[model samples]
Target: MSETSSSVLTRMGAAFGSMPPALWRLLLVLAVFLVGGIAGWIGRGVLAGPADVPTMSVYEDWHLLCPALKTKDGACEISQDVYEQRAGERLARIILAKEKDKSMVMYVTVPLQVLLEPGIGLKLGNDQVRVYQYKTCTEEGCLAVIPVDDQLLASLTKAQDAGIDVAQPNGKAAELPFSMKGYADAYGAFLNNEAKRKSWWRRLWS
Candidate 1:
């Protein structure tokens, strides 16, 4: 053994370079890829939170029966005109079912003051002679925001004389503080908000 030369060491090292010997290297490469993929997947899951919905903003200058859009980052530019002529008429259904906030419902309440001068039949919580519109648009017939009170509905006729577009649609929609919901659902949202504001837990601890 003492006489053995260092040349034998080089030969021994070379012998280990066969195909089967490369098996360990291949296994290492596979393990690296698998681990990397799993890590990337986990990182993505952590980054995307519950409230995040991918959407672009919109810009809207003119509007009629549609909500205004602001400048946004998307392929399609949503306009007020397009929204009114053709948009998802299923607003109420979409809101009640999908809106994440359990405490409040969004409503677009058009005020009578904007169009009419005085003496309305229906009244809103704050304004008199009120009309709450439902977002019920159908192919044949669309639901108009009707004044709760019939007499107030009649009084709105005065707006017509003023040269204002004031034939109150039974379903009224206003940009100023406007939203759509079924009656029950709308009320429920209000209740939820009140409950949160006066939460029992907050009262007890505070």
Candidate 2:
């Protein structure tokens, strides 16, 4: 392997070696549960009728998902899932969607073992960290719905990485990091799709 690749592997090995065994087990379980939930979600969409089937497109690490047949409230979004490298388990899922008022919203879902009091911390690149409270928790996981204003959106577009921080039930802090490598491209495409959808709807009504 190249020297750079070897160096990266060394660092990753060291990091994983330092992680606690209990944490690893917890992450593995969480990953399995989350994946199953996602599968069920997709299955339901598939069974919802041919007109309501879901479609997904990939842009680097980000995915743009939308319904086959658009409805008045059917808005598309870009999402990414962060995984534990060692066990190949999902650590968290992040989604960005646009609202009717032209505002953006970020939905972060993490394992249910997180402490809800501290909420969830979002750090984009080197900027200040923002905390969003847990809006709800279901069988899948806990979700934090954060409103993304113009400033936040700008940061996201230019950011190279994002870190999501949450506290475990035992009060230990855990961070789920994901690359922003394709965020700009994915979001741009998402905007274009939204515009086209809106235009189509307008024409239909007119």
Cα-based TM-score, every candidate: 0.23, 0.68
Per-residue lDDT for 28 in model 2?
95
- lDDT per residue as tens, model 1, 2-97: 436667876777776554747868878999999999998899678644432333332222111211112121112111211232553422111111
Kindly list the per-residue Cα lDDT of model 2 for residues 104-165, writing each as its tens digit: 89989999989999999999999999988999999889999999888998999889888999
User: Which number leads on lDDT?
Assistant: 2
**CA RMSD of each candidate after superposition:** 16.4, 29.3
Please list the C-alpha lDDT of all candidates, in the order they appear. 0.34, 0.87
Stretches > 4 Å off in candidate 1: 1-19, 49-74, 81-206
Candidate 1: residue 149 Cα off by (Å): 48
